[model samples]
Target: MPFYSCFAHSLIQNGYHYSRKSPWTASQNIAAVESLGICHSFVLHCIISSFPGLPLVNPIPTKSLEGKSLIIRVFIEQFYENLEEATIGRWLKAEGDRVGDQEPLVEIITDKITFELPAPGSGVVRSIISREKSVVPVGCVIGLLGEPDDPLPDVSAENRATLERRQREVESQALIPSPETVAPEASVSERVRDRGKVRATPAARRVARENGMDLAEVAASIGGGLIQEEDVQRWIERRGSST
Candidate 1:
């Protein structure tokens, strides 16, 4: 019997059956084998053994791999010890695009310089986990590659946690107000509640108090800023003019 016939017989004896109406596709075969807990490498070895010395076009490195899969995860590597985070400049290869070994896959922008990240192996890009112009920490899973129908593995737990932590830090920093942008209303109530101890120079305070004037009124006229002695004199002049 031919090798194909023997292979079919083996599958049938093992209780595995395929639809006769249409030929079984590669994906369907893989799914069936996975459901039966059959190793893919074993099946490949049988095929290779059947046809001795014939070159196979399979993307999987069968010689180097035992039971390992062809799925490859692309990580954001740290170029410098001090570079903990980086921005994803762009993806050179989109999802579903075939890439060559060591070809430029994406651009990583750091504080020091921007560089292209190379593909670790030859395969079709399965997914782009990180978005362009987004920031992710070193060691985070940025992309994935594998055969068209191959299953992708989950991102590393450690990398996911680090990415989440970095995102939270960025969000927290965004929520904080800058020193120059801080509103006067933040401390306006405290200053307003204590009119006697308003934020004004001693000379301004003495002049206003001796004239039976409220420092709070002078402070308000200057847009709730500190009441300098010159500011108080200007308010006095403006009041005299308005009267």
Candidate 2:
């Protein structure tokens, strides 16, 4: 009997089968198996030991892996020495939103300083473990992301805890008369654009921050004069008119 016939007989006895695209020849099937790291020596031993005159192979190629996967996770890092935890001050991108390179995904607060937490790669934000005002331990999973077409994965237990914490925070936020619930998305974009080093008094700065006005540009409206609270108001009116 031929080597292939003996191999086929052994495969049937062992309850193993091989398949490939149609129009594949016997030679093509063997080549494909060899490409997948099935060495001739191993093949002859396992599937055709009874046969004789099998050609010996020079070397066995490394196995080619299957099932490539992608992963995306955002962690709370140690921004300062001896920092143990960080607070999720706010979220810049909502769930399911696609973030590009260097884009801020969330705002984190540590030691009373706010910092932008940027995305590591361009991908869709699939899940948020921590919500605004929620505290998370350093190196914990605070968010998840993946390709736009990738299926949402089941979150880990650590993520589940953060989600629950967000729910509680939401309930607490509901008790306050905060305007964030009704703020328009455009206003949020404007706020992100307005951030940077700017010259303004604390009161004027607060007003500008509240209205999403860039103090850096708002100061130009004053022509090198002191940016007061009234100056910020005027700038807002000017911005409203320009729109």
lDDT of each: 0.67, 0.60
Give the per-residue lDDT of model 2 (tens digit) for 137-199: 665678876655544445576556655775687689689876766555544445444545345
Instruction: Please identify model 1 stretches exceeding 4 Å from their true place.
Output: 1-68, 156-158, 162-243
Q: What are the candidates' C-alpha RMSDs?
A: 15.0, 23.5
The residue pairs in collision within model 2 are none
The candidate 1 region of ten consecutive residues with least summed lDDT is 55-64
* Tens-digit lDDT string for candidate 1 (1-243): 375575556556555443344554343343333333444333343343344323212222323223445566677766778788789998999999998767899999999999898876567999899899988877677887777877666666646676787788879999999875787665665565677656898898888877777788787777676788888888888888999
